[model samples]
Target: MTVVGIGYVGLSAALLLSQYNKVYALDISPEKIYKLNKKISPLKDT
Candidate 1:
């Protein structure tokens, strides 16, 4: 699946859906994209 806008919801969905199929996440922020590519969560956990 090709998912555009890898923000909170998109990233969550991509992570969930990826278990059963291929997932591609896209975002406008290059920094966020780079962070995600490195397996880093852009959002901070409480």
Candidate 2:
């Protein structure tokens, strides 16, 4: 499945769907793209 955007909603959905299928996340933001590419969490951990 393909998911556009990497904000809260898009990222969450991608994570869920990625469990069962290959997920392609697309975002125009360089920062977001970079973070995902590096497997870094965009949000702060608890």
Candidate 3:
């Protein structure tokens, strides 16, 4: 599955779906992509 955007909803959906399927996340920000590629979460936990 290809997920466009890595915002809250997109990231959440991708993470959930990834458990059972292959997921590819996309975003406009290269920084965000880089972070994700490095196994980092762009969203901070409160």
Candidate 4:
């Protein structure tokens, strides 16, 4: 499944859905994508 945008809500949904299904999170930020690819949290929602 493809989830567009890796924001707080989007990322949360992707992570939750990924447990049972394949999820590809999409975002407009290259830095964010790079961090996510490296298993790092892209945004700190606090």
Candidate 5:
């Protein structure tokens, strides 16, 4: 599954869906993609 835009909603959906499926997250921001690839959260959260 390909999830475009890794915003709050998109990221959440991707994370949830990923548990049972192969998820590929897409974003226009290279930094965000890079962070995700490195196992880092792209967004700030508590």
Candidate 6:
């Protein structure tokens, strides 16, 4: 499945669904893509 937008919400949802599905996260932001590729949070929620 494809999950557009790799934000916190998208990431969480993708992770949950990834257990039984292949998630292809799409985003226009390079930073977000970079962080996700490196397994890092793009935004600081704290």
* Candidate number of the best lDDT: 5
The better candidate by lDDT, 1 or 2, is: 2
Candidates, ranked, lDDT = 5, 3, 4, 2, 1, 6
**By TM-score, how accurate is candidate 2?**
0.86
Go through the candidates in order and give each one's C-alpha lDDT: 0.89, 0.90, 0.94, 0.92, 0.96, 0.88
Q: Which parts of model 3 are misplaced by more than 4 Å?
A: none
What's the lDDT for candidate 6? Answer: 0.88
- Candidate 4: worst-modelled 10 consecutive residues by lDDT: 37-46
lDDT digits (tens) for residues 1-46 of candidate 5: 9999999999999999999999999999999999999999999978
Per-model TM values vs. the true structure: 0.86, 0.86, 0.89, 0.90, 0.93, 0.80
Q: How do the residues 1-46 of candidate 4 rate in per-residue lDDT, one tens digit apiece? A: 9999999889999999999999988889999999998999998756
RMSD of each: 1.1, 1.7, 1.0, 1.0, 1.2, 1.2
Report the error of model 4 at residue 17, Å: 0.4
* TM-score of structure candidate 5: 0.93
Off by over 4 Å in 4: none
lDDT string for model 2 (1-46, tens) is 9999888899999999999999999998898889999999776657
Tens digit per residue, CA lDDT, model 1, 1-46 = 9899887798899999999999988888999889988988987777
lDDT by residue for model 3 (1-46), tens = 9999999999999999999999999899999899999999999878
Residue 42: error of model 3 in Å? 0.7
The RMSD (Cα, Å) of candidate 6 is 1.2
**How high is the lDDT of residue 41 in model 3?**
93
User: Model 2 lDDT vs. the true structure?
Assistant: 0.90
| lDDT of the structure predicted as candidate 3 | 0.94
Greater-TM-score candidate between 4 and 5: 5
Distance from true location, Cα of 39 in model 1, Å: 0.7
In terms of TM-score, how similar is model 1 to the real structure?
Answer: 0.86
